[model samples]
Target: MAYGEALALQRDLAQRRIDRSLDHDLLLLVEHPPVVTLGRGSHAEHLVAPKEFLAAKGVELFEVERGGDVTCHGPGQLVGYPIYDLTQHRRDLHWFLRALEECLIAALRDFGVAGERRDGYTGVWTGGRKIASIGIHVKQWVTWHGFALNVMTDLSLFDLIVPCGIPDVAMTSIQKELGERSPRDLWGRALDAVVLAFCEVFRQQAQMVELEAVRSGA
Candidate 1:
């Protein structure tokens, strides 16, 4: 699904939690429209596009409730939504975020891409350009929303906005950086890498389950 649709689904999943139906432990992977999303309390100046221009460009804007400044998501990006119960892991948000970064780092390592975290920043990076972005919201000790990794996303789309409010920082993709060594089967390899990373970093055995998409209101 698209990132916008996935965001809507996150809301739906949260509502399901409110209604006490859906499992608190869930992870979803999706991409988003070419949109710039700013987190809570982020400055409007961070976005380089005017409201009208963004609409004209077919890009949507969202002032999300996550815990970061601004970031972009579009096609060929891998966005992960991990809906997990923090209570199951001692309610350590820091630990959870670290684990998330570590998971991505491990996944990238499998592809010969060395992913690392900045001293104070959250997302994974290689050299100077950021390859992944993370912004999440937690409610009732349960977490939702998550990270977006640039697999083969159009790096130019990032030029239209200030990514995570960081200026002059480059953006990259696995395919772009790895060059000849990058996996030809990106989606398949990424799926396996991320799932493996999840199990390794979280120190838990996760059962991969598949479910058919339900029609709206069903």
Candidate 2:
């Protein structure tokens, strides 16, 4: 999906949920083309590449409302946008962030990766390298712009910016961790693990629905 369209979809879903027109929580998943996003907490200096450099590399950049520093998304990454209502769950952002980490960690365990959290960090890491980055924006307690898990993403993309605004922070992917043992459908497998873990952690029976269904208020 394009970053701009995804952002619009999230806003639409979030507004529907906030207005009580949407009856269920949603976790919309996608893999975006190469694009850099700046969150509300992003610093100008965090982006290393200039406009010409990124344009030449075919990477699009945008500013978003998510709560984090700058981050990039591309093919081979799993981006999950959970349009969840916090009122039905815990209303605390701290708890919500931790719960997101817990789900990612549990999902990583399925792939034999021991994911952990660093103090004062809001993501799941493994072997001192970040495997996933999480940033969200909640309006009226309805969340949008969720986590991005590196499944088989090119690590070189992180070079274009200071990932999560941390200097020299290493980003690792599932393909890098599993190497030759990784399945050909590595992205699909990772998505399955994440959905299972999300169901367990959020205590919701989530099933994948068509984009049209979601768009038409189904």
Candidate 3:
């Protein structure tokens, strides 16, 4: 999905949840074409790529309302936007961030990846290499703009920016951790593990509702 489309979907879903039109929280999963997003805290220097360079590469750049610095998104990355009502969970943003990390860590564990949380960092890492990036925005105790796990992402694109504004940062993927290439098999399993982890972490029996179901406000 395009970032703009996903952002619009998040806003619509967030509004539905806030207005009591949507009864349950949602986790929207999507893989975007190559793009760079600058969040509220993003710095111009962090995005080192020139506009002409990005345009030449066909990588779209968007300024977003999420709560982090510049980050790259592309194909083979599992981007999850959880439209969650913090009121139903904990009202604490810190707790919510930890919950997201826990969910991804657990999901990575299922794939034999030992994901860890680095001290002073707000994302999940493994062996000091970031495997996932998380940033969120909440309003009225409802949240949006969640995390991105590098399943098989092109880490080269991250060079366009100082990812999450962290200098000397290294990004990894499930494929890299496993030291192998695939027939694109692991992404499905990884996606399933993520959904299960979310269910377990949040204590909800989530059903996989289609996008149409969400679009129709069902």
Best by TM-score: 2
What's the lDDT for all of these models?
0.82, 0.94, 0.93
Candidate 2: 10-residue stretch with minimal lDDT: 202-211
Residue-by-residue lDDT tens digits, candidate 1, 78-109? 88988777777768888889889999999999
Task: Give the runs in model 1 whose Cα sits over 4 Å from its true position.
Answer: 18-20, 211-218
Of the two candidates 1 and 2, the one with more favorable TM-score, higher being better, is 2
Instruction: Please identify which of the two predictions, 1 or 3, would achieve the higher TM-score against the true structure.
Output: 3
Candidate 3: Cα lDDT at 175: 85
As for candidate 1, its clashing pairs are 3-31, 3-32
lDDT of 3: 0.93
Candidate 2 to truth, TM? 0.98
User: How many Å off is the CA of 39 in candidate 2?
Assistant: 0.4
- Candidate 2 local lDDT, 102-183, one digit each (tens): 9999999998989999999899899999999999999889999999999999999999999999998999999999999898
- Candidate 1 vs candidate 3: the lDDT winner is 3
RMSD of each: 2.2, 0.7, 1.2
TM-score of 3: 0.97
Point out where model 3 deviates above 4 Å: 181-184
Q: Residues 46-102, candidate 3: write the lDDT tens digits.
A: 998998899899999889888989998999899999999999999999999999999
